[model samples]
Target: MSRIGRAGFKKQVMFVLTISSFIGALIIGGAVYFFETHQVKKNAAYLIQNTTRQAAVMLNDRLNLVFTQYNKMTDKTSLWRLVNQTYQEEDSPQKYKDILECYRDMKEIYSANSEIMDSLYFATSDGTSIPLYKDMIFEKRKINLEDMFQKNYEENYGYYWLNKHEDQVFPTRKPRYVVSLIQCFKNTKGEAAGYMVLNFKSSYIEKLLEKAQISENGYMMLLSDDGFLGGTHVEEKYRLSEKTIREILHKENENMEKEGFSIYQVPLEINGWILVSVVPVGDLVSSSRQFLVILGITILIILLIAGIFSLVSASMITRPIEKLTERVIEFQTNQNVSFPVDKNMGYEMRILAEGLSKLKERVEELLRQVKEEQEEKSKLELLIVQEQIKPHFLYNTLSSIKQLISMEENQKAEDMCEALSRFYRLGLSDGRDFITIQEEAEHVENYLLIQRYRYAANFDYSINIADDILKVKLLKLSLQPLVENAIYHGIKKKEEFGTIVISGYEENDFIYLKVFDDGIGMSEEELKELQTAVGRGKVREESNHFGLRNVNHRLKLYFGEEAKLVFESTYGMYTQVTMVLPKTKGEKEC
Candidate 1:
């Protein structure tokens, strides 16, 4: 036989094939594992962002229909006189009887939307009024009538469709938390005759939001510059924080991932209100679980097969070796069939290959454990940052009250003292930053109320929240700075009655908090400049432009990039600021 075609060369080729096959299998298996894992996460992110945005837009359209219906009623009425001209005397028996018929007409329109309107009523400047009720009987129910306008009226006057009187110059004629609308009626001579009110059940917004969710189990909210209008659901103790609202409202429509949730937002067509959706990170993890298990099994099988092949190849490469003069072991093959193994051809080479395979397994395992630790670390760091509250707020508040007392303003000082007490009591975070969002809201509310007392009538503020998200937990003072800016910078400088609204609710897996002001909103130039500063992560100390550098830093530091501050404003119109945070429950710190 020719030396080039020797049987020894065939054995060498076989050995080389076996070793290469094993290596190839491992490379293929690992590549597939990592690529699949990344694809799963990518798909999960896409699902949430796409689904939430669609849901928001759909809900906004449906709610706009409801607003349109009420708007049509107003438009139709505005074209005609309020009191029918058939009756000659404005207050004669016939005229009063006709007026009842006229209000009944409005009631009929209200009844058309029984699903949305709890009751319908009309009130005039001089106190002549009408009401439609489900039971037509006055019943007293204990309610924290604290948020009368946002809960009942529009701030409501802030929305060009309604007007506010001093201390709600009108009576509470309907149930709590209804959409309150006030419209005026003029006579043929263009003289003011009277006004009408439409009390829409708050459910009108909630039901639509509930129905339009991409997932059967996700959080959603309806919010405006006046604050949280309503929500469909809330995660346990996961109240949205004001910082979160600033984040979302900073942009018109946003999809973001923060903490343990995927955040989505869409604007409401009627009120510049935003519909925000939150989906939990856990859900995304679960969505890819089955795929992971299958991929894991496939990878294990490939590794097992590779090991078996390697073992078989090692057992087969048995070409006789020249006897070692020094009695050392050696693998032997002829020159015609030579393949380099760095000159090491002993059985120990097979052992080394086995060790390498095992080493790769250990490396993968260590990587998995490291990944898990990274996730846990993220959660722990969140708790740590939340606890990092600045104590100056309490000190400053106490100082302000002390000054008021020293100035001999006893009644105002007493009120300030009470508000300060409540603020601290709610701020009682047990030296931790975490508290139920409801409590955090109350804390911020107390702060705003105190400011309201000090800024008396300069600007009015309101807090609106949905019931389900009340138990949400958040960091302390996340809201105060935004509201403080709204009062001192935006509203105080405005000529008319400016408003400070704080609202929080849950969306999907995240809690959304919004602080909006119907004050001197930022111009495009100023808004862009401020956003640029925030994007650069700078917090300016000046009160002008409602500096939010400090709040931005805190939110980003704790929540990572997902925690965001959003801003939206039209100079001379209104300013909306939002923040998004995790919907973690409980006040426990790590």
Candidate 2:
């Protein structure tokens, strides 16, 4: 045999191959371990974040439902009659009759959603606490209804949410913990008539948290500025510590990791409550540990095989290894590159290439999933904004209707109710996003009609659209908010009666819809501030220009950057809001 096939050549090749395989294994295995661990953590955090957000939305919706039910109940003529009746010092037949009627009404409302609610209490200024299921029963723990009203009703003008507490009003029943919504209603003279206390079952919220739980070890919790309200895990040991709660409350960051746990927090819009999701880091990366063990064993096996091959065919092995290294480098530089398996590249090389190919596919799949998730999140946010707008308008309109009924303007109230029905029917548009300009115009007309009844001599309005553009498609509720802003912020504030002109026209492949108000127009400073706010397209909790901001956001979302809201105002003279929409081809009603 030649010197190349002798002991010297074999020893040299074995040492070099052993060293190379060991180093390669460490480098590749470490990179994979880091990547896999990072991906696992990222996915866990994303899931937890979404869970917290969705929980908050669900809780908010439930809370809003309570308010909606409250509005409907309070709007009842019988309930209004009961609140208006003064409590006579002497027990009279009429007093008992009023109580009975009120109890029946409350019972009906409670029965509809009794699974979610514990009891409903309608407390009057005269110190009567009427429960839904039964008559007022005075127990040892007598809840002073007047004292409760005086303590909270005055501070919180409209409504407020209470923490979990024992059901004091219904002490005779089984001991049950509950969360309460306390709202005060006012009379025609703006004086407090009575209060409505709707107690929600705590177990219902706990169930919500349980349903929102992300993983076996991960759990969800409801928190407020004060502390923990409730959670999925009832055990003290399973619950998050006070320190973590405090940190979450004080920190502005929505997501944080502390004490081996990843925490995601979302604030509720209905109340200033917080929804929190907690997941263990160990649980998030538990699979990564198994992957690392398998990887290590595979690396050891590959190293042993390489050592054996080095003694047999060192040149062939080295050439293929160099080609593999070059391919890996190329892939590292450009992730779009594919690692294709070749029949001549040997079984081990082909297996490695296949692994690389699968990794690339997985990465691309994750990217696609992320993109879809982001789109869904945006759509959800838009839906939330739409929901927020609806409730405020409904509450205001219902209040107007209530006032009209109280004044006994039956004819005007009937007209307003009809207008409201039409307004909502068109506004909903069968859940379609785009509506014809004619339908949008009609929706705004109904809204204006309702406002006309509310502010009889305060303002007059006109909607003028070219006949040709009426069939063009536009976003639903696009003009109604602008019309509302013109009324309340502009016309209603002025001393003299003002005029609002809503005009629509098509010009140069774009449509211009304008709401012009001859009322208390904004000052230069105010105009600039309002413009900047809408330009940024972010909703501020304290801002009174939500209508304007919301409309501008929706416009930009659907119509791209070319679509915008143009504001023109001169202080104490006039304000005009023009919505610029890019006309889409083949516009038709849905």
Candidate 3:
């Protein structure tokens, strides 16, 4: 053959070999990419599925813990012991004081579990129930044991629900639900003596779901086996619908009865109580596209170095983008929202990002409106509070006089009436928010005398006004309500003989007035609620007094945030409320 013919043949062979090799590499890369992408999606799906199951298991465990706490708080043995101590036998003054102590201790136990308790009650056989957990109060009422207690026992024996008022003990107007179980107490003869009720709040159980650390975008819910109970902290729309939940009820109910784990593709049935976990599934699988893009870029660079497999690398790049596009579409359809991506994305990615900016604008507008509305409401409420004090003083004064006249102490009572008049008149003395400690102390002393006459030595109070603090600037009426709470709930409720000791002194560039009382000390839960109420300045009408909330509010309003109230209490013994006041010059330490 001629030399030129041979050379031409060699070139044709080389070109054919290179093209074939590039095609082979492309085919291999395509196969690997497809397989890896499938594996990634499967792994992501598996992660989400397993996490859902685990969350379900944890949720069930937490619900069981809530039940266990409810039972513990409502234990018949302890409650009956309390009932017998309080009612069955006549108790000495000291013994009665001890009972209050025990009640306070029980409050601690319930307080520790308040996360799951809406409100707990100690209902006596006589139909009087005192709220021992949360801040619940029920007025004494006539109730039929069989109709209220027995019926509730049958209805709530083995289930949980949004609680209706068990009976007249809880008024119809209150907005609290009781998730409770009852335990029957026996007398010495083993007859049914009385019952102890364990009540949990719906919000408390919701807090349990919240505390489980469910993923921010994912949530697990506890549904009744019968489909009668269900709630979630996640957004409302994400919550499983009744139709969807009822569908899995059979399986859920069956699982609740069974002794082990239950799995079902369908979430509803009569026997199927479910742990339904919903997660943002697309967020979990984006790693595959990231890996594919990285792999394609590396292959393209390697091919460019030798012009081998360049076609294959380009095909690899296009393949991943197409797969990612399909996933974005699937996610959009399932979630009923556009994919959260940028609008300026390349032509292939524009669909996901188009409506995002408009959504952002709408969200911002909504937030702005919400903020303005909140501020306006706060201002209006504050104005109303400032104007409402006049009526409150007039009312408390009239009640005090009515009690004194009913007792027929016409002479000493007149002086008290005069003192009450003087106390309110002090508010007009200075338009300034601040007043002297002496003036504040006098206000409390007048109030205390009126209470002393009403409670008739249920409590004894002592005051020591430090000479230095007497003329120092203090918040008006700051000391009165704390002293009043000590007398009413702490002393009168628990002790026939209660003593409150008040002292004022200087400490660390500040003036402190200490009000310590040997009254019925509060349990941990009451103390927590009291602290929250103080912090938020919220007053509950059922908490037996509106004065403390108002007093604390005024103190914070006047004292520049540093002058405020602090308290400590031990059940059945003593509670101390401290007023922190900034010191003024020329204050003598008394």
Candidate 4:
């Protein structure tokens, strides 16, 4: 071709490339925008739906737990028998004393488990009501209870759930929202003696709903056919349209836009409940506009690629300008370019992209590694905290050892000193955290001996270690905590010295190490709170059982979830703490 022909050819190539690039950019931009918008909205819907459903399930579970606890307290057949055995008529002085004792025991049980109960009343067939509260029965309750039970009442009607009563059995207290579960109990022959009515305040349901909600703006509402049983997260002056809530539950999965707000709803069918979450739509979609800039950059990069490809494949004619183009084409073909860059900016961006690509793999690996490393650190921290008091005791034991040496009883002195030395040795054994059950029993024996000497045998201790379980491994300092708590918290406050029994045995797949103290034991309420905290893996700030909790955590960490600490206590009687450990560590080894 001539010079003029080649020049026209170059102009035509540039024109076609410019038009095609513009059209292709528009197409690519539209695709990105559409794809991003669709995915983002879809993800938003999924997140809200999942969150709402979880909130609903949590509501159902929490309510069920509350009711189940109350049911167990009032409906146990054994409890009814005890009640009858306590309240029998025409009894002698000894029998009446037994009745009073049984009544006190029932009062304690009622107080310990009644976190939500407003009143628990026992109405006799003779129209007499015994309301257990403040350690005294309110006699006036029978005035209202006269209507509750008919004379010579027989056969149990099971339980009746009374809603919205607001009836206060006690007249002195302020009135509140009240619901009662009324149940009639019968003797073994199926003759009803009386009724037990359990009353609950609205605050109980409020607490339940509050615990169930997982989101800040989210609220849970208990709906029945009657509408609005109870709920939480209700804002003052903010009207909730029942129709809108029903519509949301029925028709919408994404945003249900109302005036200035959008609602998402999930229904829990178990208890006729609905969980509603509301957010301003602007808040949901405001950040999503960032995708527009990303789409624009993506189209610009695509256009650059197409333009470079066309330039590389253009004619190989030898004009002055064509020679320059031929050189550009040759460079493009011979070298591997990171991007279709005509200038310095794209080349700089390509370097940045490569750096990010290199970091991406390391960042992902670090994320997975960090969680496990952090967990290990937490376990070590627990160990360090539990081992805090060792040095002071060691110093004291050494002082005692010196005193024993001065007494001219070299055998006794040597034995005490050896025990002291071995205590620390077993504690810091090769810097390991676990030891055999036999070693743990020895450690506690040493502690008891030291204590026995210090207090002049003010408290006696008995250690019974089963030979079969002696080979089982446990965390260091596990047994000492329970013994120390028994001594200081139980025996220390008692008028007379008490006996502490440390016993260990293997049962099925687990090892049970129990510390029992026959001293001024904890109340039923104290036991209940402690057991609740242990079950939830929460330690109370005011609790004196830090060592026990620490040991409990380590056991759970090393011995699977089957490992835990259990407590049983009776006021003015005794307290027993059992540390349950799995026989093997399973996947988590020492």
Candidate 5:
């Protein structure tokens, strides 16, 4: 009876082990498949999006070059003279001479950029066309200049980009499509003198799209609101219908997936044209499919080996697991309890024990880190308060108020008192670390206003900040310290009166607040030492530059490591101090 009980117990253990191993394998393999597929799609989208944007930039650059040359030609006095002169009147010799001069100038420009230009010409108001290189055999079908001008011209000034159309002015045996840029020139009286036409070959745009291709099956096409302009490496079946083109143009999202293809669109700055890139989804995830297959085969083999090992090792694994459980319970009560590394146990059991031992040490280290962080927080708060209210600044402001009152300037004194009160109120910010940029600007304005009275004609200040960035949130009192530094260290030492300019603007996910002064600046050695100190972000007790270091550290602590202070100066010439911080909208309290 006892022998029979032992055999039944071993069978039960083997059954449980096999079931657990199968479930774990399924969970792990499914997770990996999901993650790998997601990662592949994200990477493909990034590549195609960047590819389309770069292609748009290249096309815009080429078109801008053509526009520049056209502007130069229009600015020429000879071209204007040719357009204003009329051959109907007498003096045929002078009319011919003016035409020849304008044609020669146009020919020079065309020769320089012949690779992109199909033809360059001018159409005058007197119903005459002057071509740089006239066709030897003129086709009977002449392009209607009046109809073309009326249809393409939007305003009476600037250039207009017309849709691609068949070439009619230039004679060719084969059918050729070209995009035209037309500009209406005005005479001295602001009257429409004539229109200048510059034709650009469509093939040049297609070549640019070809260079921006991202994959073997990927292609790019340029589309306007009306229709498609040009495409490169496009298959016949992938040609978009009129309805589909409208849908793509009106879509709210710039990047999307349709059918089995990933599509990315970028708007051209030169003209209102969309550059679209199409890539196959299958191509992007082909490697992921292969990875799934390998993962499945590996999991199956692992389960098979686990099944065989379970029958022999089930009893061995159960004993150590039971022992480890008791130790875990003990650790919960007393974290000092150590997990024993038993040599007699299996390899997995030994590894688990070693891991737990390391975990205990990590927990102790984390506690120490938390304590240090608390101390640092307290120190930062104290520094902020100290920088906000300086004893010398308060004393000088009061003395200025006293002088203004004694001179019977009660109104001026009252204004000074009011500015000081508002300054302190903003500095407190109701105990909040972050405030809107507008509030910070107002605070610094108050500080500078009071200083103007104290320094009198020694310095003057101006604040020029963009309205769009005024509502963005930033650390409270961020600008005051920089302004203080500029006045004390920069402008005070100069011989002549100095000017301090404060400017703020947002660009590319960053906020730049600059304080500039034309005064005695630091030499290279002094500037280098100051930069090093700012980088360390440690406040020196004995130094007069602690305000800068304090602000730098506080910015990093609240915002991130990327927030910093940058300094630029030339000895005895000028100084510029900039506070760079991330552009954030939400108000984060301390």
Candidate 6:
């Protein structure tokens, strides 16, 4: 081959390579711009759709919970439970103190209406107010002539209203505004007991609607069906200003066939509610313009890379770059990359890039498999651990009973054995998280029976469960641990035959359980410490080798914050642990 001939061949090769490089650069630049733009649009759409769905679900759940809680607060059986306590008429000072403490507790539990609550208060039929304002307690405040209840009482109607009340405790005594939600409370005998008034501060509702996440340039407005706009995040002038939300609906198509819904109907399917969500067209356009600028910047970056490749086109190298593009596409599609022929590929390039891609694929597959295996192992371990704990309790109880039997204490031993059997049976029933109220009560009854032998004549139990509550769902051992706490901490040391009452009933849509014992109880300080421990998830400690911590943890684990163990104990007298459970449908019968 002559030098000129070889040189011409080389030039021809370079020329062909340069043209290929130019085309490749153009294609790659276009691909990058297209891929990035598509990703941006996809991400934005997904974000909007997911956020809206999540917001709806979260808000609906919160609303349902609030309604359930309110129902519990108004339950007929729960109210009757409060009035049916067997306190002595010739009561000691300690008895009065106990009653006062119980009343205070009831007020606190009922007052936990969340940050969005307007106001919550309990009023007796006699116009005595049990007001719970934040941490302050006002017991038995008599209604004055100017009281809001006066008009309602005179009218002989149970109704709520938007009104104001002077803050007697405050120096200003400025009449603060409130939207009252009032209902007539009835006893178990179907007689009116009192009027329960929940006065919600308008500001609280305003904050709730404001705190929720909203789309940019979007606003939330709440209005009554009767043209009364209560609150909104719109302009200050528009806040609380009455606007006919339904009138807007009527204007949309006046002659259209009317369904059950009003024209200004809220977007959601909630009952008796008007929620309006509006976003200005201008804001959407403005935001899309900003998105376009971001897209332009991405295009510029790709164009720069194209310019670099165009300048390098005269060089006869294309295989490495092409291989890299192919690998990237393979990764984007979640497919394994095929190995290119090594005829023109450099050994270093092949090992550096392609080798790493292959390694990543192998690693991902291995991780996925390992994750599944680990989850299975964890589930198995949990079951084994639970089984192990139960047998340990059962073995000890059975052994104690056997020893009693050998000592010719047949009655006590038989009772202990029967209780132990029932307890184990309840623990093993269907292996589900929830049981009926009767089932849970029966479990507690069995536990108390076992304890009775342990502390014979030391304490007596009086259980008063409402018939309506028998079908309500409750955590398996909700009452048992509380009862155990009363016995172990309150009555075990007392010489007298103290009374421990275990009772449960349904209120609006909640199951309320109370385990009370008239024995030696702890001071307020100790109770606070216990609460703090439970709140921090550090309920278990070496000093407290008891099941109360376990009970608190399990309650939280199952029912969230709305339902957990709560208690109030008076030193040297007695302790009462109360549990609140949401009414879950379809709980197993005893």
Best of the candidates, TM-score: 5
Give the whole-model CA lDDT for all candidates, comma-separated: 0.61, 0.77, 0.58, 0.64, 0.77, 0.58
* Candidates ranked, most accurate by lDDT first: 5, 2, 4, 1, 3, 6
List the candidate 4 regions with Cα displacement exceeding 4 Å: 1-379, 382-389, 402-412, 532-543, 586-590
- Over the stretch 1-590, how does candidate 6's per-residue lDDT look in tens digits? 24554465456557655655555545654665476556654554444445444544554465456556666655544343333333456644544464455455445544565454544555554434455566334333454323544444433244443323333321123455454545564455755555555555556555555564444544544444333323333655333223344554344332111221111123333333345444332333335565567557656765665566556653544656676767677866775555554544454454556676676678779989889757644653464346425676667677778789889999888778778888878865677767777887888788878877765556788899999878776656656667767776778777677999888777877777888899888788988987776566533234362356666655665576676777788898888888777765323322
For model 4, name the residue pairs that clash.
Answer: none
lDDT of 2 by residue, 286-367 (tens): 6456666767776886677666666667674577667767877987778778777776665555667788789888988998
Could you give the C-alpha RMSD of every candidate to the true structure, in order shown? Answer: 25.7, 27.8, 29.9, 25.9, 18.6, 26.9
**Residue 231, candidate 5: alpha-carbon lDDT:** 56
Candidate 4 per-residue lDDT over residues 517-573, each given as its tens digit: 988988888888767655655443345555676667667766768888888888889
lDDT of 1 by residue, 1-590 (tens): 23433455466657666665656555665666578766776787677667667766765565466567656655553224333343445446755655566566666666666776656555543435565666345553322212222332334432333211211322356535565555555456654455555666566656765665445346677666556654425755344677776777776547776655677776755556677776665555556666668667767776777677667655455432222311122212221222233234444443444554465567669979889767655654453343333366556666777887888878887888888888766655666656666787888877887776665557777899778777766656677767877776678778678878888777877767898998888889988997877776433344243236656766676666777889999988888889887654322332
Task: Give candidate 1's error at residue 331 in angstroms.
Answer: 44
Tens digits of per-residue lDDT, candidate 5, 1-590, equal 43554565556666666665655465666666678777877887787788788888988888887777667767766677766764456767777777787777778767776777777768776666786534334354555655655644555245677767777766667767778777776667765667777888788777777777577677888887555665534676655556666878887579777766777888888776788887777767664566668677768766776776676666655887898889889988888898888766555667788998898889889989888878877877777777677888899899999999999989889989999999999999899877888999999999988888877758888999999888788888789989988888889888679999999988888888999999899999989998887777556545667778878887888778888899999999999999888775333431
Error of 5 at 298 (Å): 32
Q: How much is the lDDT of residue 263 in candidate 5? A: 78
**Residue clash pairs of candidate 5:** none
Candidates in order, TM-scores: namely 0.39, 0.43, 0.34, 0.36, 0.47, 0.36
Residue lDDT tens for model 3, 414-455: 977887677666654456455678887887787777667656
lDDT of 1 at 338: 20
Give the distance in Å from residue 28's predicted Cα in candidate 2 to where it truly belongs.
2.8
**How many residue pairs in model 1 have overlapping backbones?**
31
Clashes of each: 31, 0, 27, 0, 0, 7
Alpha-carbon error at 475 in model 2, in Å? 93
